[model samples]
Target: MSLSGETIRKIREAIKSAFPNRDELVMMLRMELDIPESEVPDGSNYNLVVFNLIDQLDRQNRIPELIKGALNERPGNPDVQKVAQEINAIYSNLSDKPLLKSFEFDVVTVNAQGWKISRKRCRAQYFTEDLGNGVTLEMVAIPGGTFMMGAPKNEKDSFDYERPQHEVTVQPFFMGRYPVTQAQWRAVAALPQVNKELKPNPSYFKGDDRPVEQISWYDALEFCARLNFTINVTTQRDYRLPSEAEWEYACRAGTTTPFYFGETITTDLANYRGNSTYGNAPQGEYREETTTVGRFPPNAFGLYDLHGNVWEWCADTWHKNYEGAPKDGSAWINDNDNPILRGGSWGNLPVLCRSAFRFYDSWAERDSHDDLIGFRVVCAFGRT
Candidate 1:
């Protein structure tokens, strides 16, 4: 779970650039990693001190956590931000690609009866797409696996559309680490149009890091098309919305629970309306607006905003049920005008945010967009 040496070097450079003063760097590390002041390696040479601290954190498998914390703590520091993006891109272009690089994390599971927390580990390969202007998109590698795709008959508030609990075999692919952000949307929007024009700023909640909402399914497809045209010169993968089966497989992250974290969700874990309770979990804050991506914890596969933040657009057309659905994880398309949406939004009740829950845009209109909807992109596995 140790970060690659190149990643360490980039991080060190970013740290040095962001905090030139040795005392400031040490203090930032202490506060970010919760390391005691006395425990920081004592050295007059700043580089050695910083290297020692990074080495210790890497050995503890906290490098990902450290990078994320650093970025969140100093959102304005372009140097630190670039380092995070570069590190993710570095893994993809290495001469000797290490596809097995792994990480460890803790996941929570809750139910009407009670709650429990446990440590989980996963191996992932990821690459960052540089969208220009210091904006980047991190795409995590989801390994191929088999999983049941729908809710069981006895699950609480389960829907008929999510029925029969069929098994689906999904192929490995790369998924955006978080939903597409406003900065990323603007960058991609600026790219030469492939099919349709794009509005640079469509999100109601305005932040560079916040997920870009008010996007139609057609708009999402165009974003992927434009991105594919830009990135395919070097990497031949196609960028597109994930198939519904792949979305559920990745969201579940090897779990069968109603949600990735567990049987029920709490507002503490997502951005949905928290005034309403789910299972035994008590009612929590209802933010009523989108929050910054990565503000909440990720699932086991290192994906964020899978359960909430905003309902994500999926590739499949609307289907009444799992009956005759594609078992091979391809998009289920058949001339249906309505498109599917998953992973409920900030304004939705907790029940709608379950991993198995399903929603569709208005049947009459295919061009609809709103603040409650956004999407992440996926790249084919072998092409990269």
Candidate 2:
């Protein structure tokens, strides 16, 4: 594909941002292109380094090869993969043959005692939504499946609200790869308001990559509404909060264990309070603050931070139990004013972070902002 000067400039800026470390840049260049160490530029000027590397790759007609190498080497780095996907989209637009894109990742599991059980490779398809100003949102395709949607009675720390361990059939849908980050929140907040006005910076921890907390359930709805309004013009897709069933099914990722990782969770796997341990798991560090999204391993479905970081708001209204929950993967709604919250938060215990754990705030407190609250988005299939 022939990249114009403007396209080249954008790619250079993206590459520089994705790889700011001089050593990492040189390592990628040497690993991808097999460039001799002496020939590579050495300096703190990442722009110059990226410029030379891109120039070399363009001259050799090996830009695509470099992108592939980056994807393979840094699958967890969303910025790198975002740049690759953007370039691939450009190539697809200009050529008859489109480049192959993959979302391969490593899935790890632990036993009841929190011991490592297994590790396997998995892959899923995803699409990127450009939110402008170099920030993008990644939505992974969750496969349709039938799974038990709640905690087993014998499970430790299981609650009545998570009881009845009934079966639920969830249809295929797309979900955010991580909890909504501050950068993503800001981008969508800047969009023309759909209902309520959003504060540009509402998070307490304060990092562009950290999950946007202090967001009420209503604020999350507005974010989705604005996003749908903006993207539906071109894609005709509806973006909204995930249903309670869909949230549990996606978080479990076809696992019956308390966590997608296995029987127990530790501070190493999630961002909950580390002073408390789940099952036989040992106590770990209490970071006392939110870490960047995707700082931990993802589930089998390629979704990250589903266990902790912040509680994710769901589309369902607060219910006492699964007595009359929906069998199909749709939100259970009624005249209730309170909304359901899932996935626990950084300040919660490991038990609260369990996959089947469910929580809700009072109707009077529904609009109140809590630093422990945030959300991710879901897009149904066939909307386009």
Best by lDDT: 2
Q: Highest TM-score: give the candidate number.
A: 2
Error of 2 at 233 (Å): 0.7
Candidate 1, poorest ten consecutive residues by summed lDDT: 91-100
Instruction: State the local distance difference test value for candidate 1.
Output: 0.80
TM-scores, all candidates, are 0.72, 0.73
Local distance difference test, per candidate? Answer: 0.80, 0.81
Off by over 4 Å in 2: 1-100, 382-384
Taking all chains together, the TM-score of candidate 1 against the true structure is 0.72
* Candidate 2 local lDDT, residue 53: 75
Q: Report the lDDT tens digits of candidate 2 across residue range 243-271.
A: 99999999999889899999998877899
Rate residue 317 of model 2 by lDDT. Answer: 85
For candidate 2, the per-residue lDDT at 3 reads 77
